[model samples]
Target: MTEVFDAIVMYQRDHKEKDLMVKMLTRQAGKRMFYVRYGKSKRYQFAAEMQPLSMSTFEGVINTTGLSFINDVKATRPTSFLMTDIVLNAYMTYIMGLIDAAFVDNQPITKWYDLVAEAVTKMEKGLDPQGIANYFEVQLLPVFGIQPTWGQCVICGRRDLPLDFSEKLNGTLCQQHWDTDPYRMHIDNRAVRILSKLAEIDLHLLGSLNLQDKTKQEMARLMDKLYDDQVGIHLRAKSFIQQLTGWQNRMINRQSSAKEDES
Candidate 1:
């Protein structure tokens, strides 16, 4: 039996010769993998719409006992600009990988699909790629029930405390808590405020906001640690981003400086 659905291509792998294996995050059925023959032929080369972040329509059979095969695929919007720019491509790849890792098969996360679609559209229209990525991470956490406590102290529940997002407490920690625990990751009030604002804004408006370099760097670190701790590892695309953004180079320089200082 064949069924039709709207889907976003999450990842694709070339199989033997002309075959392709595609992982799609569908609006109706969630994450699913499908096999397609002649997927690489000139006539169907546009079917490379199966590449990461392409939104499309799919018609296929759900193989109850074996690998599923898709009979028809039509690209709705290729989101092709995600591939044209280096920074946008890396951000989209990381977010797509996050969705692929977190959601289960056939379980609908309609809101997430919409958020991703919107983010891609914004990027295509010339939005600040880094800010959009930070916004996506903030909004995504709440949807997954992994929201970091930022409005108040995660440890003491003190609403009046100074803002300091500490990973040790898993949220914004008050000064008292920070003073008591020397191991906590100290995030300043500016960073905490930016995170709080990012969580509250509509995804479409993410492009309109301006974020300081320091805040963006801090938020990136916070998000990287959060995903690594929750998802058990970082996405390779994210590491690619750190390299492009000079994050890895800075760390190496800092380590070298520290070694020289010790000597």
Candidate 2:
């Protein structure tokens, strides 16, 4: 029997037999892989619908082994820009890719799906991609049961001062426990306040914080470390983002040096 599901594409890849394996977070069925016939030749492939970050209705037949064969796809949202625009393309890649790395198959992903959908729409509305990515990381980490304890010390029941963030302990540490772990990431009050605000804010309304670059870097570093130490699913897109950031920094430095030489 064939079934239809409203879904958002999370990750996609080429199959060995000239087909496509599209991993989607669906409204009804959670995460699913839909294998499309003739997905490579473009004669039958719905490129827009098959692209990652697209919300589309997927009509497919599920096999006994839980795999699905996509019969058709109809785009439910305008997602062509996700492929065409370079910046949006990269943002969607990381956003949906993180979701892909976070959840298991066929689980109840309705909330996560809505979160991804909303994030995509927010990006389209001109939200800061880096901040949005950080927001997604902070939100998704909790879903995987690996969030950092923000307000108080993980030891001695102290809430007066949160001094350090320990990825190994998965929470904040006070001065007493600060040097206890050599691997603890230092957490000043400012960074703690920033992370606390990140943890508490509504994702939909989080685009205009005016955070400093250092704060943003700290948030991203802590989130990535938490995902690595606890969640254990390595996100592939994150590496690419880092590379892009490094390249941009090098270009900026080169331009700065040129200006200094001229002066």
**RMSD of candidates 1 onward, in order:** 5.3, 3.1
- Tens-place lDDT digits, model 1, residues 111-229: 88888888888877777677777777777775566867876778788867677776666678877777766766566577677777777777856656566777777777777777777
What are the clashing pairs of model 1?
A: none
Question: RMSD in angstroms, candidate 2?
Answer: 3.1
Put down candidate 2 lDDT per residue, 1-263, tens digits, no spaces: 88887888877899887778878788777787877767776676587677777788778775545677777775478877677876677767888777767777877778877777787777777776777777777777777877677657877758676567877777778878887788888745566666766677887776665656677667667777777777787666788777777787789899999999999
- TM-score of each model, in listed order: 0.80, 0.82
Give candidate 1's error at residue 168 in angstroms: 2.5
Worst 10 residues of 2 by lDDT: 187-196
Candidate 1 weakest lDDT stretch, 10 residues: 62-71
Error of 1 at 154 (Å): 2.7
Residue 85 lDDT (model 2): 77
Look at candidate 2 and give me any clashing residue pairs: none
Candidate 1: stretches off by over 4 Å: 62-66, 73-75, 139-147, 155-162, 175-177, 200-207, 229-231, 247-263
